[model samples]
Target chain A: MEQAQADKNNSAIRPVLFCECLEKDGIVRRVAAALLGGYAFTWGFTALGTTCLVALGMGYAEAEVAMLLLAFLIFLIVFLWAFAAVRIDRVWKVLGGGAVLMTVMAWVMQHLLLH
Target chain B: MFNGFRIAMTWVHTWFGLVLGFVLMVCFFFGALSVFDREIDRWAIPETRFEPQPMPSFDRLLLPVLEQQLSPDEQEYAANMPKLHDAGKGPMTPRLELPVDEYWAYTTHRDPVLAAGGGFRVPHPKDPTLENHIHGRVTIDPRSGTVLRDDALKIGSDWFYPLHYKLQWEWKDLGYWIVGLAAFSMLAALVTGVIIHRKIFREFFTFRPWKQTQRSALDLHNMTGVVALPFHFFFSFTGLVIFASFFYFPLSHTLLKPLHDQHAVLEAQRAGLPYERAGVAVPMASVDAMVREAKRRWAARDMAGEVGFLTVTHVGDANSFVSIYRAGSDRVSLVGEGIHFKASTGEVQYEDPPRAAVSEINEFLTGLHLQHFEHWLLRWLYVLGGLLGAVCIATGFVFFVEKRKRQHAKMGGQGSRVVDALAVTTVTGMVIAAVGMLVANRLLPIDLPGKGDWEKWVFWAVWALTMAHAFWRSAPVAQGRLNPAWCEQCWALGVLAIAAVLLNWVTTGDHLIKTVFTDTYWAVAGVDLSLLGCALIAFWVGRKLMRPTTYEKNAVNRALALHE
Candidate 1:
C-alpha cells in the first residue's frame, strides 16, 4: 500500500519538476566556474599591468601603449567573469579559485619578463 | 561575568553611537575627502591648472633689488653679517663694495645709507580686479635676479585644504579641537562595535538580500561593517594619532619646564621659531651666488628643489650663515636638515643626520601621515581604506537604530518619539548639514562686510539650523506612515540645495563646462561632479524609501478585509 502511495505521489508531481531541479544545479555549477575564471582574469591582468609599466619606466611610449592595451583586454575579461559570478548561484568558490589562478599567473609573468 | 560585561558594553556602544554617530559619519566622510584635499583643489579652481613652477632663484633679482631698496647703512649691515656662531644671537654688520668693471676690484663706500640697515625690493604691481588675487607673473632668471612669471595668485588647491580642515576659520583652535573630539568618538564607537558583535566572522559571509525591512537593514549593516573592519580600525586609530600631539601630548610647560608647557615639550618648541631682523645692515654675500653654491654642494645628493627660506643672522658680522632646506617639506616640519652654508665663502656647514634612528622614525611617521611616497598605488590604497572606514561608521549607525526600533515599537509614544528623533538626525540631518554647507559656500555674498568671516559664520549657522529642524520635525516624522518610516523631506531639501550650487556656478559664469573645457581642464571639475554624484545618490535613496513595503501592502489588505 505504501509503495502504491509512493507511485501515486510520483505521478502527481510533474516530470518537469525534476528537470527544473537538474537545470538549476547545472546553472549553479556554470556560475561557480565563471566566477573563478573572472577573478583569475582580473588578478592576472592587474599584476601584469603593474609589472609592465614599472619595467618599461618611460623607456618607450610605444611599449607603454601596448602594455596598456593588453591590460585593458584582461580587465574586460575579468569584468565579464565578475558579472557572471554575481548572477550565478553558488559561484563564490569559482571566484576565489579564479583569483588564486590569476595571482599565480601574474607571479609567473613577473618572474619571466620583469625580473 | 563575561556575558554580563558584553551586555553592558553593548549598551554603552549603543548610546555612544546614537549620541554621536551621525556627526561622526560626516566627519569621517569629510576627513576622507580631506586626504585628497589638494587634489580636490586642483580639480576645483580652473585658472591654476599647470605643472608647478620651478622655484625662482632668489639672488638674481631680489639681491639687486635689495641693493636698490636698502640704504648704505642697510648694505653695510648686510655685508658685515656675523656667523650664526650661537643659535640665539642676532645678525652681524653690513658693508658695500662697488666694482668698477668685471675685474675683481672694489671701492669701499662708508655711505650712511649702507651703515643704516635698508635693503632693496622691486615693488610687485598689484591687480585688484582678479578674483583670486593672483595676477602679473614675476619671472626671475634662476641664474640671475630677473623676474620671470609673476601672475595672479594661484588660488587652486590653497583654499581647498583649509576649507576642508577648518572652513578657513583661524581663531581659538576650536575647529581643530572639535574635529579631534569627533575623531575620538568615532574611534570609541568602532571599538565598542567590535566588542558588541559576537559572531562577526560567522556573519561575514552571510548576506541574505531577500530579507524584509529590519532584517534586511541588519544584514546590510553587518555586511558592510564586517567586510571593512580592518579598514575601520586603521582609519580611526591613525586619525587620532594624526593629531595626537594636539589631543594627548603633554603641554610644553609641563614637559619643557622652561616653556611652561602644559600639553608637551614639542608643542612649546614651536614658539616664534622664525623671528624677524632689527633692520641693521651688514656686509652680505650675493643671494643668487649663494643659492648656486648651495645647489652645487648638494648636487651629489640630488636635493630636489630650492631652500624654502633664507635667514640672515648678525647682518653685518663675519659669523653670518645661510641655511637652505628642501621646499614643500614644511608640511612635515619646518626644520629640515639639508644644506647650510657660510654665506661669505659658500662653505658647507650642516647636513641632516642620515635616515637612521630618530630621523628615520620622524620621516616614517610624517611620510605615512602625509602620504609622501612616490607611488600612486599607495595613495589609492589609502583612499580605499578611508572609504571603508566611512562604511563602518554608517552601518554601525543604521544597526543601532534597527536594534532599538523593534523594542521601541512596543512603547506607547515617548519611546518611539525618541527613536524617531535619533533616526532623523542619524540619516537626514547629516545630509542637510552637508548640502547646506555647499549652498552657503556659493550663496554667501562674497562682498559682504568681512566676507571671509561671514562665510565661516554661514556654515556654522546652517549646521545649527539643521539640528534645530531635526529636533522640531522629529515627532511628526515618528507618526508618519511611510514605510522605512524616515521623513524624506530633509533629503529632498538636500537634493534641491545641491542643484542650487550648480545653478549658482552657472549663473556666475564659472560653470563647470566653461571652466573645464574653455579655460582649464584640471581637477576643479572633479569637485563639482562629485557634488552632483552625491545629489543623484540622495535622490535615489529618497525615492527608494517612498516605495511601499511588502509588509505594508499585506497590512493594507488586512484592513480592507476588516472593513468589508
Candidate 2:
C-alpha cells in the first residue's frame, strides 16, 4: 500500500514538473519565433513588394521607399501574431515558409525584369 | 498562449518593455538632448559660441580652403587604402597625392561653422565602377575660413546625437542592430500596452504619488506613456524609416543594386547630368555666379533661402556639375530646390522639379525627426516628448522591480535586485555621466593633447563607476528595501550639474550675468539655465527620497504606541 502511494505521488509530481519545463520552453520558442521569424518575413516582404511594384511600372526609388515605409508596420503585425497564435508550428509555417516563398518569387521577378 | 488575448497582450507588453526598457532609456534621454545639439555644442566648445552664420562666400573664402592640398584622414586611409588600391595595377598613390574628385559643404540654420570635405579618388582601383574615394573633412569658421581643431569633438552632435541612434558602438554596426531591434520592440510594446490598458483615458489624468511604490510607479508609467503615445510612436517609426535604406533594409544597394544603377544612369540621362567624369581637365566656372543664379531662381519661386548644401561633383573634369540646395529653414523639409549648374560654363543644367508625392512624404518624415527647421517652441515640445518617453521607460523599470522585489525576495531570486541596480544606473547614472563629461570639459586644459578623447574617457569612466556603485548598493534591494544608491546618485547628479555650470563660468568667463543679460548669448545661457533647472529638480527628488516612506512612518508610529 505504501509502494502504491509513493508511485501515485511520483506520477502526480512528474507531470507538473514536465508541464513547467514545457511552459518555459514554449516561451523561449515563442520569443525566438517573434523576433527572428518576424525579421525574415519582413525582409522578404520588402524585397517582393519593392520588386513587384517596380515591375508594375512604378519608379524604383518610389517603390523602394513605399515598401520600406510599410515594412515596419508589417513586421509589427507578424511579431504580435507570432506570440498570439495558438500553434507555434503554424506561426513558423507562415513566417518561415512565407519568407522563403516570397523571397524566391522576388528573385524570379527581378531576374525576369533584368532579362 | 495565455488564457485570453488581453492576458497575452499584457504578458507581451510587460516582458518586452522590461527587456528593452534599458536601451529605450538611453535612446530617449540622449534623443531629448539632441534636440538642442548645436546649442550644447556651443556650450561645450566655447570657441564656437558665436551666432549662427550663413554659408560663407565660396569663391573667396571656401575656394582657397578647398584648393589647398589636404591629406586623407589617417583612420580612413588605413582602413580603406588597401581595399581601394590594386597593387597589381601599379604603385600605390601617396595619401596626399590623391586627386580631388569632389568638394562639398554642409551647414544648418543652427550652425556657426561650416563643415566641408573633399573626396580624393584612389588610383588603380580593383573595381572601376565602385566609389573609391578617401575622404578628408574640416570644420571652419565660415566668416574667416580658419579651420577648427579636427580633434575637438562636437560633444553634442558627435557624442549624444549618435548615442541615441547607434549607442556609439561601431564594431560592425552592432549598435545599429541593437537599436533597431529596440526600436521594433518599442513599437510592439506600444501596441501591446494599448491592448492591456483598457482604461487609458481614465489613467491619463491619474497620478497618486502618495500611494505604495508599485501603484504610484504604474500610475506614472501609464500617464507618461499615454500622454506621449503619439510622439513615442511617430519618433520610433520615423527613426526606423530614416535608417531603413541604409541600415534596416538596404535593398537598394544590395539586392536591387543592378536595377538601382540602371535607374540612376537613366535618370542622369533624362536630367542631362553627367553620370561619369569626362577625364578631360577643365578650368571650373565661378561657383559664386552659380550660387547667385541659384538664389535668383529660388527667389523667383518665392522660396528664397540661403544655401544649405553645395557640392561639386567630378571636380576639375569637363562633365563636372555644381549642385546648390536651398536651406529648408522656413519649412518642415530638408534642403531642397536643388539646381544643377554646368561647372565648365556656369550655365544652369537642370533645375530640380518639385518632389513627387512619395518623395515629399519621405522627406517630411525624415525632416521632422531631424528637426532642421528653426522653430524654438516646437523644439522644446520635442524635448518634452522625449523626456516623457524617458520617464515612461524609467517608471516601467520601477514598477517591474517594485511589483516583483518582495515576491522574488521570498523566493530567494536575485532578479529584482539586478534589475533595480540597472535601473538606478541608467536613470541617475546616465545623467551623472553626461554632466560629469561637461564638468571635465570645462576643467581640462584647452590645449591638452586629445582633449576630446579625454572627455569621452571621463564620460565612460563616470558611467562605469556609477554602475559599480549601484551594483554594490543593490544588496538592500534583495531584502525588499530601497537601494540608497538612487537617492545618493540623485544628490551626486545635482552637485555635478551645478559644478558643470560654475566651471563653465570660470573657464569661459561667461557667467549667467554676462551670457543672459550683458551679451545675451542664448546658446550658452540656455544650456547653463537648463543645467541649473536640472540641478534644482534633482535636489528636490533627492530630498523627497531621503524622507521616510508612509509605510515606514506608519510602522514606526505603531511600534512606538505599542511600546508606550
Candidate 3:
C-alpha cells in the first residue's frame, strides 16, 4: 500500500516538473532564434538575394540599394517567424537548409553563369 | 506566461523599447525640428532675414566677380581678412569670412518665392553661413550685375541638421553608428508593439486622457504609436538603409568586387568625368555659356528649376568639365539630373538623363525623407509625425517607471529611480538644452570664433549639466515621491525660451511686432513666434508641476494625522 501511494505521488509531480523544464527551454530557444534569425540569417539572405538579382539580368548598380532594403524586411519577417514557430528544431532546420541551398546556388551563379 | 504571441511580443516590446527609448526620443525631437531647419537657421542667425535676390547670369553678373577674385589685388584683400574674434570688441565686431575651398554656383530655395523667381546664387567659397546666407555669397541683382555683400556669412545647416543626424560628432561618425543602432532597435520595438496590440485598430484610435495615470499613459502610447505607426516604421527602416552602406558596403565590395569596378567605370562614363587633365594649359571656355546651355537643355526637357550646384573640374586644363545639376524641388528624388559640359570647348558633353529604376526609387525615398520639395501640408504632417513619435516614446518611459515604481520601492527602489532620472534628463533636459542653445546663439557675440562650434558645445554642456541635476534631485524619488528635476527643467526651458526671444529682439532689433510688420522674413518671425509658444507651454507645465499631486498631499496628511 505504502509503495503504491509513493508511486502515485511521484507520477503526479512528474508532469509538473516536465512543464517547468519546457517553459525554461522555450525562453532559451526564443533568445537564440532572435540572435541567429536577426543577424546571421539576414546577412545570408541579403547575399543570396542580391546575387540572384544580379544573375537575373539586373545590373548590380540598379539592384544594390533595393536588395539592401529588402534585406532589412527579410530580417524582420524571419525574426517574427522564429518566435511564432511551434517547434524550435524545425525553425533551425529550415533556416540551415535554406542557407545551404542559397550558398550552392550563389556558387553556381558565380562560377558558371557569370563566367 | 507564454500563453500567446501577444504576451511574448509584450515582453519584447517593453524591454527592447525601454532600453533605447532615451536615445530614440532625442533623435526624434531634434529630427522634428530639422524639418523646418531653415526657419530655425533664419531665427538663430538673424542676419539672413529679408535677404532675397533673383538668379544672376553666371557670365554677365557672377563671372566678373569670380574673375575679380582671381585678380592680384583681390587676392591680397582676401589674404589679409581679419580672423573671427581676433578683430572683435563688441556688438559692432566685424564678421570674418571663412576660407574658401572652392567657389560653388548654387541656387536658392531658402524661400519658395525666391526659388520660384529663379534665384541663382554664387556662394563664395569663403561664405560659411546658413540659408539666404548674406555673407560671401555674391548675389548680383541678376538684372543689375552688381555685387551684393562682401561679408555674407552663415552657419548653414550646421547645428540642427547635424545634431539630429550625427549628434554633431563627426569623428569617425561614432554618433551615426549609435543612432543607427537605436533606429534598428526601434524597428524591433515597433514590430513587437504591433503584435502585442491585439485590438490594434481599436486601440490605435483609443486615447483616454482623462483616465488614471497608468491606464492613460498606456492609452496615449498606443494611440501615438499606432497613429503614426507607418511614419515611425518607414523612417526608422529608411534611416538605417540610407546609412547601412557604412556597415554593409564592405560586404558588397568583397562579394562583387568586379561589379563595383565595372559600375565605377560606367558611372564615370555616364557622367563624362573620366577624362584626366590633359597636361596642357588652356583658357577655360565660358562657364556662363555652359550654364545657359544646360539651363536650355533642362528647360527643353521641362525639368528646369535652378542652378543646384555647379562643379568645375580640371579648372585650366583641356579636359576640364563643368557639371551643373538642377535644384531638387521639381521632383521627388533628392538626386537631381545634371548636364556635364566640356570646360575647354563649351560643347555639351553629356545631357542629364533619368536614373535607372532602382536608383530612382532610392532617390525618391531619400527625397521623401528629406522633403526639400515645396509642400507645406506634407511638411507639417512630417513634423507632426515626428512629434507624435517623440510623445509615444517619452510616454513609454513614463509608463514603465510608473508601473514599476511601487514594486521597486518595495524592493529597494534602485531600478525605478535610475529610469526616472534618465527619463527626466532625456525628455525635459533635451528641451531645455534646445532652448538654451537658441539663447546662446542670440547672446554670443555674432563674430565669436567658431560661433556654430560654440553653440554646439553650449548645447552639450547644458545637456550634461541637466543629467547631473537629474541625478541629484532624483534621489528623493526613491522614497516614492515625484522627482523635482522634471519641474525644474520645465521652468528652465521657459526662462531659456523667453530669453532667446528677447535676445533676438535686443540684438537684431527685430521684435515680434517689427518682425511681423517688416514681414520680409516670415521664416524668422514664425520661428520667434514658435519659441514664444513653447515658452508659454513650458510655463503652464511648470506651474502645474509646482502643485503637489494627490499622492504627495495625502502622504503628508497621513503622516500628520497618524501622530495627531
Q: Taking the true A–B contacts (Cα pairs closer than 8 Å), what share appears in each candidate?
A: 0.00, 0.52, 0.31
Ranking by lDDT: 2, 3, 1
DockQ of structure 2: 0.30
Q: What TM-score does chain B alone reach in each candidate, compared with the true chain B?
A: 0.66, 0.98, 0.82
lDDT of model 3, residue B160: 64
On a 0 to 100 scale, what is the lDDT of residue A75 in model 3? 72
Per residue, candidate 1 scores C-alpha lDDT tens digits across B1-564 of 112445434443554455555556655555556555554433322233444344444455344544443333332234322221122432222233321000010001100001112232211212212111111112223333433222211222233334434444556766655554455455555555666677878777777655555456666667776676666655554544455434332212122222222212332243222123334344656756766766665566664444544544333445555655554432333234455555556666565445433334434544565553334456566666665656655655555444444434444334445555555554566446555555554565544454434534554676576566656655543443322334365466547557755754764555677657887533455556666766777777777667776766776887799799
Q: DockQ of all candidates, in order?
A: 0.01, 0.30, 0.19
Docking level of model 1: incorrect
Q: Which lDDT value does model 3 have at B70?
A: 25
Q: What is the alpha-carbon lDDT of model 2 when measured against the actual structure?
A: 0.89
Question: Of the pair 1 and 3, which is ahead by DockQ?
Answer: 3
Candidate 1 DockQ, CA atoms: 0.01
Off by over 4 Å in 2: A1-25, B558-564
**Per-residue alpha-carbon lDDT of candidate 3 for residues A1-115, written as tens digits (9 for 90 to 100):** 7579847854542211223434766666675776564566666666666677777877776677777878777777776666666677777877766666765565566555446
Q: Is candidate 2 or candidate 3 better by TM-score?
A: 2
lDDT of 1: 0.46
Show model 3 residue runs off by greater than 4 Å.
A1-37, A82-114, B1-4, B52-108, B111-156, B248-251, B270-272, B548-564
lDDT of 2 by residue, A1-115 (tens): 7579857854542211213424764777888898899988999999999889989998888999999999999999999998788788999999999999988888888888888
